[model samples]
Target: MLHGQSNAWAIDYDNVYNDNNLPEDAHWVRTIGAMHVYNRPAMYPEAENTNWYVASGKAPDIRGGIQLVGNGMVGVLGLNIGLNLVASQNVPIAIINGAGGGGAIASYQKNDSGLNAAYGRLQHRLEASGLKLHIKAFIWNQGEGNAGDAVSDYKNALYQLYKNLSSDYTFEKFYLVQTPPGCSASSGHQTVREAQRQFAAEHLAVKIITRHGFPENPLFDGNYFLSDACHYHAHGYEMLAEWISNMAKYDFYNGTVDYQAPQLVRVIRESGKSLSIEFDKPIAVQPDLKVDGIVYSVKDQLFAINSKKIISISELKVDSKNNKILRITFKGKRLTKGAVITYVLGDTYPDTKEPYRGPWLVDADTGVGAVGFIKTID
Candidate 1:
């Protein structure tokens, strides 16, 4: 099962660089808005009009089965990849896409409204499918809409959604795709990300895939977005599909999967020139780790650190008492009032192959790092 908002529904398979054909054994059903439900077999074409008006198996366009509607690329690719992996072991598979473009987490609660009113149409599809078939996993790729929501509210709402779905169906595992770093307008992304991190940590059956390094657009540079900087291109979807398929295979086969990211909890100043950076989990700091910062004249003001004098770290050590804390001492004048320090992970040593340039501080086991942090002196 697949569910989420626009990013989950956006499709750009036609623009994919390499050959990304659908699997022969895969089939899908989609709930369109509140009124229409379309079913399709595998190997559906991309040229057909993906609307209720189109008939299945029509010439010039194969209409039956799942058609790429709007920017709905990744869901189909992900499903194909998953089913292919399962079929390699002689297992037959089908998928249900119960997603709505622009759908928010709040809209899909037990009591629904808008396109999802009365528990929305997704529930209807799930109920109908649940009667005869058993669900394997619930793959969720949402949270872009909830980027502005309070962390607690988003967490609670997501938990409720999980509970409601579990009660309605029997699924072995739940996979959540961490929100992409596209929604910069919403300041609550970090909060939501933290909420997701915490929730996944507490739940054993839940797994989260990271979207840390995915480019907003693959074609051009200069902040080029896939589509409006929020959605992804076909290649992006394909990469996401690769992650989904791998996770699905592991979970389906009862294999243990890593689903944790290093979390930055706090940054405390121990002295005028020293600071203690804490993480929720233990981290392995690379020997090549470097720190570059600007001495801000005013606190809470954002500026281009490149133009200012760069402060170098005199010492960076792991706390012997607590592995989660990093003792950082910089060689400079004591930090005074109204001075701010900032450092971005992966900026100095960016890995083109890594996700988000690989987080600065990574877990020894998973190599996922805590989110970057900033400190402002009072």
Candidate 2:
């Protein structure tokens, strides 16, 4: 199932901008409003009924609330990519699209009103499709409307959406697109983005499709926007579709997906003044922990040992035997028993070049941050 806002709906590809050409091999169905259904079958005897009809390029209006369709052009490039991925593996794919253009996360809760009512319709269509197709994944590309919402509120709402979907159906994985860099200057954008990052980091089943290295379309002179600064053009959509395909292919081929996050496992006292911090996974250590031939002092990188209190770290070294462990020596006062160390708390080190110095530890391979944790010396 594909859900979310305009991005998932492909609002940018409205009829005015481009034609919605149906792919020849694509076989899919879609729901219109609450009761009507439309199918775009690979072979046509064009299925039609009082409630069902054959879908055309422009049959189901983009403005219509909820829909389900075969993996065809259907405006949603991402869904098309998903369908193509399934087809490549010689499998049939059917998709249910429950998306609203300007919808917020709150609108899709268990019982939401207004345009968000699409969620209810989406559920009805899924139940109505008695094919008993095993759901593979729920592809979500939203969050722009909530760009101004508080991070905590957005996070909670997002979690609820995931829970709501899980309760409604059984699916293998959730593919969450790290929403585009919309209104980059908006505080809500950053908040929601960070919340998404943190959520994906903590949830094992949630696989995030990052937009980090995505390039702007050269057709737009490398500008991130298409016709509007908020949406993407054909080229941008193609790139995004490719990304979705890659992620889908990875998940489809392997029973398990790769998630890289440097998790803080525990903190052990090596001696009176030395401490060893262990992470759940191996990490990349900066070979040269020095700038301009001078070793960076513990005061420079070490943020806090216990309770946000700044303590000078006389020496800091990655353990020789275990790259996941970092050994630290205090300059003056030794850490007392039960001293809790906190690093990268909130968005503290906003400008730090080294991720290890920040509140969240970063995995070298994926550059994904580890969930921040508080560890007490034992």
Candidate 3:
């Protein structure tokens, strides 16, 4: 099951998979904005498209599964999820999506007093399929519309959603995709990201999917990663689906793989002149940040605040002894306990055409970026 706002619905040049050539009994549905369900059977050999394909066959297409009515925004990730599953495990998968683009978290909630349209749509789709009450998992990617709400309020609402969904449905796991850093109009975008981080830490079997990979050039005219600042291109959606499939492989299928993205395990102000930003796992320095011949300094996105005096960061690199610690260097100066450190500042660009702008330090092999954070030096 895939749910949430625009990213879930998709805004891309094209879908990751062409739905016309999917495997047997692999079907999907979409209830983004309105009901557009698809029940097409594009039966082909399991090995046909090893990397990408959509869903098809053996599902009742009650109400014509996934018809793009209005602008034909066709990049629902359910298709890629099904395709990857079938390709990797040869198991036909079914995906049910109930998402609305530009919707508030409150809107997706279960309102008992009145007609809950989102809830109704999902229930109807579940009933339409044979799996009336049970789903394998719920994959959620939301939080652009809740920009105005306080962090606490938004989190409370999300908690309400979690409660309602768990009570109302029978699903194994709930995967929450951390919101992409884009909504330039407000700082709420970062707030949403932070909220997601905290929420995932507190919950169990609840994984936070990092929708990473931003443009190498922060000032690029256009990005291949996203259709716009907020929405995803096919590349963006593909990255997201990859992680989802990765978790499934490692957790459920017992596949030997490292699917987790690197996050800040601890940040140590190791003396005055330097800070050791340690990750949960071994990490490597992304050697060149220069994009299109422009020198994009990694430290520009990083901030180290010393109240007594201003200390400019001289260098940021992987620690010599430890692969996990990001060694932040400065001239010989003492960083006090109350000094603050923040990453990816100035993330939003409201006035201009570009909306989301930030920097990242990525995983060595996978290129999965580290989570953006703002924390006081301790």
Candidate 4:
């Protein structure tokens, strides 16, 4: 299902998978791929298992066009992942060994480091290739390694990761896997989960996939997880994958946009003569409008109202219900009942949140204190 212009490659910094597991006759390794780069696992296994059969070597220098493979979690370190991502244009999807017993921190560290590095690489490449990379969604599930003091860092770590990804990816959309239940809501894992929610709330881009109300014993038994208490034994991973895929396929705001009322509304008056504006809440005009453009003289006033920009208002109506009025610039002007006037507002400049001023204005009505509407809006 990996559709692109490159072959799959496995880079293992964790030593989670080895050559013995992928010998010429080894089914899993051979079937997986031939390009494998094994690194010393940040934390190697206690008693070697069937999976850790590969040997570590001088890591390969991945240039580009390579896909990544690993166990479920990654997103901790920056360098290893950065390199992995640099080796490929397609965002790397890793599959790690799911049986490690380090609790939340272990999995989180590995998964987070890998994911973050990949994102960083994607950002750099997108910038160079003139391509825009956006995160449509995410699938995260980890909790075993987060049992103690290491737990406090979990939430912030995840939040920071999200912040970095959103900034680099230019898209904030993501999906969060709730920490599995039955681990006592007061546990460190639970603490991290709460932090995750707080982070999601502060940003408009993240959504938590509900693992709440999930039956414990009965459901686990019915779902085949009864055999393995820690990780998903039977159909859990499949079910989880299906759920994540469904969410990722659709817009994250599928049914949640209506609940959020617009908050920040602003207007830019290039000519400084416009005072008409709009926002989620009303705003007052500056007593004296002043906007400096590339080449222009004469100070003009501007205001944003109801998320719209208005110009040349003699005065404004005070609304206490909405603390909006800031200044009063338009007053004591000639009365032109319906005579049109023109004013300029801000312009959209890339990489800057600041709106630029445009001296040009269209047909706008003039009046002693008339509110001129925005003729052309960006």
What is the TM-score of each predicted model, taking all chains together? 0.61, 0.58, 0.77, 0.35
Report, for every candidate in turn, its global Cα lDDT versus the true structure: 0.50, 0.54, 0.59, 0.32
Error of 3 at 344 (Å): 2.7
Clashes of 4: 65
Q: What is the lDDT ranking, best to worst?
A: 3, 2, 1, 4
lDDT of 1 by residue, 1-378 (tens): 677765555344344322244344443322222222222121123212232211111111112435223212324444445455656545544454555555578655675342224244455545544331477778877886776566578889889988988887788778877664554343435446656766676788887666653333435431223435555555566556655665666666654644344555666777877777676778666433111222221111111122232345666767998898877776774755456544341111221211222223455555544443234543
**Candidate 1: misplaced stretches above 4 Å?**
13-20, 23-74, 80-84, 112-119, 131-133, 184-188, 215-224, 254-378
- Model 2, span 1-378: residue lDDT tens: 777766666644444333346554444433222221222111121121113322222223333534433222234454456445655665555555555455577666777432225565566556656522467788788887786566579788889888988887888888877653443333325456657766776788887764433343466545435434466555555566666665666677652424434556788887777888887666554332332234433345434665454646777767789778877787765667788775433221223322122212344554444434445678
Q: Write the per-residue lDDT of candidate 4 for residues 19-112, one digit (tens) a residue.
A: 3532232222110111122222322221121232222211232334242233222211111222223233233323222222223333323233
lDDT of 2 at 100: 48
Write the number of the candidate with greater lDDT, choosing between 3 and 4: 3
RMSD of each: 9.0, 9.2, 7.7, 21.6
Point out the worst 10-residue segment of candidate 2 by lDDT.
41-50
Q: Against the hidden true structure, what lDDT does model 4 obtain?
A: 0.32
Best by TM-score: 3
Query: Per-residue lDDT of 48-112 in model 3, one digit per residue for the tens?
Result: 11222233212221223343322112244655676676678866566666655546787677755
Error of 2 at 53 (Å): 7.8
* Prediction 3 TM-score vs. true: 0.77
